[model samples]
Target: MDRNALLVGGAVGVVVVAAVTAVLVPGVLADPTDEGPIRPGPVDVADVSIAAGPATGETVTLGIETRIDHRGNPTQNVSVLVRAIDAESGLLATTQRVDVGNISRDGETTAATNLTVPREGGYDIEVALYREAERVDQAKRSVSGVSAIKPPYLQSTTSFTDTEALPPVSYSIEDAGEDRTTLDLTATLTNTGDEPAEDLSVTFVLRQAESNIVASRTTVDAGTISAGRTDSVDATATVPSGYNYYIDAVLMRDGVVIDTARGAANLNPTRTISVNQTTEDVELRVEDFEDDDDRTPEDYESERTRTESSAPGFGVVVALVALLATALVARRWRQ
Candidate 1:
């Protein structure tokens, strides 16, 4: 047994030495440029910081401002991702991703990521700008500036009311069914709007590739949305096979349609929200995934199970453990 143990130890040493030699070979070592240079172009992300924002659970948003180009074009399609690490162990805790829409005409973009952080703690964020798939530029954030956050999902809106109604509308069975369909319908109405709405009637307009509707209502409603909160009537239609269709939540006031947008509902259980719908042919929205978490329950359970099962392995280690156990057996000149 001792001889076999020595042979195994020798083999382990040889393997370790070979691995070291392989790493030391020429062209094997990493280049010094592995740490890429931070060259911020016309846009500056100096203020890009991660903060716990208002989401149901532990959600985070990166806040930042951009320095515009001389032409006053804001940085388009900024991708900000945050990865939280354990300050004590330096272990990666969580990762999140967000996409900020086109920059303002003044070349300014704020740090609002679609990524949701499921847990709370210190995190490091990377702010990047991309044109297509290629990264045009990016910047890393410091952990010190990462603000701590807590819970409560509430939006303070003095202008908007909690309870509102919709206009009376009838549906034309353009095309739609359980197997194949596309529902397209239009609403006509007016509004009694007093204040401008942050989320106008356009917000209720649900346009999905699965559905197509051309709503040309003569009325612009009250102002944006408030002018057209009326009662909802059945707007049903037959959806055609493979035809694109979307549910548009409409608003009406005094029998006239005002704004569009606000009819998007995920009630069918399909994960896609048609956020790709464009205003002026551009999409400007971000959403968090339902399964996103700082640490999944399965991961936590797996770690615990491994640790618990490892107790026996420690016993094996103690058993396989090499110890110099010497015994001094004295005898009185036994013949």
Candidate 2:
């Protein structure tokens, strides 16, 4: 081959080899189990509430409240970013990033963040929902600035809004004392929310059965309790006699009803009696009658005369004939 032709042939062969290697080596060396990035599904954001917006000079800390809903597929490595923009100047005032680890398919989450804005002005808050690097949804709202010196309304206010459901409470009644007709109503309060519970009060009502009349009522305050913690309180109430009774327990926080529990109690003591029937025969025996030895001679003679007068004439004749026959036989033996 000529020099130029040989060089071209060598280059062609090298290119062909490189192409084959590129196609086959990847398939042969690549692990079949190595999968690529996961595609996330749709997400929805709604119900954004600005809980607090206390501003101090140029810096304002925003309390953003919102709910995130995941749909269709589960997502991992999710995050949320909130931005405060000055609507007049189109300037961004603050930004906050929240790391939402994972959300299951069709699941929902409530997110709250306190973002510190570096400027003081009227702004519109924007929330961007993301799964990894992709933005799935966005929401925005406008809010007024608040004073930093004063306490946040969301923290100072005693309302059930945004508060978790109260833990369950169970009530039981036991004797308070032996000398009195009073009972101790015990209420066990449990905290099921992820946050602390405060300003809790429980009201116990002991009512007569099937009647609205309250026999005894008392309220007990159970102070602050941590999440998943259990606390209890006792109240003394007089239980009346001769009537069935029940108990109604109400759990409250900031004058809002968190939970309610009801139970019945049997106050009147009682006894039970059972009667049964059986089939069986019984027998009786009597002793033979004997004459009294202590009887006087006059009494015995009177008794004998009455007996002789009452006897049958045939019985008397037979007795006399037997005696005479016995005497005759004895006399003949003697002769």
Instruction: Compose the digit string of candidate 2's lDDT tens values, residues 227-309.
Output: 87666676777765444456778777666565566655554445211112112222211111122565689988998998988
Query: Per-prediction TM-score, please?
Result: 0.24, 0.32
What does the lDDT come to for candidate 1? 0.43
Candidate 2: pairs in clash: none
Give the per-residue lDDT of model 1 (tens digit) for 1-335: 69999999999999998789777786565677786553333444445544444554445553434332312444455565555554546666556565655555554545554345444455555555554355656666655433334333222111222233532232344544564343444443433445433322322333443334432222222244343443222333433233233455444333334333433322233333443462222221212111235568997898898898777645665555433221122233342
What's the TM for model 2? 0.32
* Candidate 1 TM-score over all chains jointly: 0.24
For all predictions, the C-alpha RMSD in Å is 40.3, 28.2
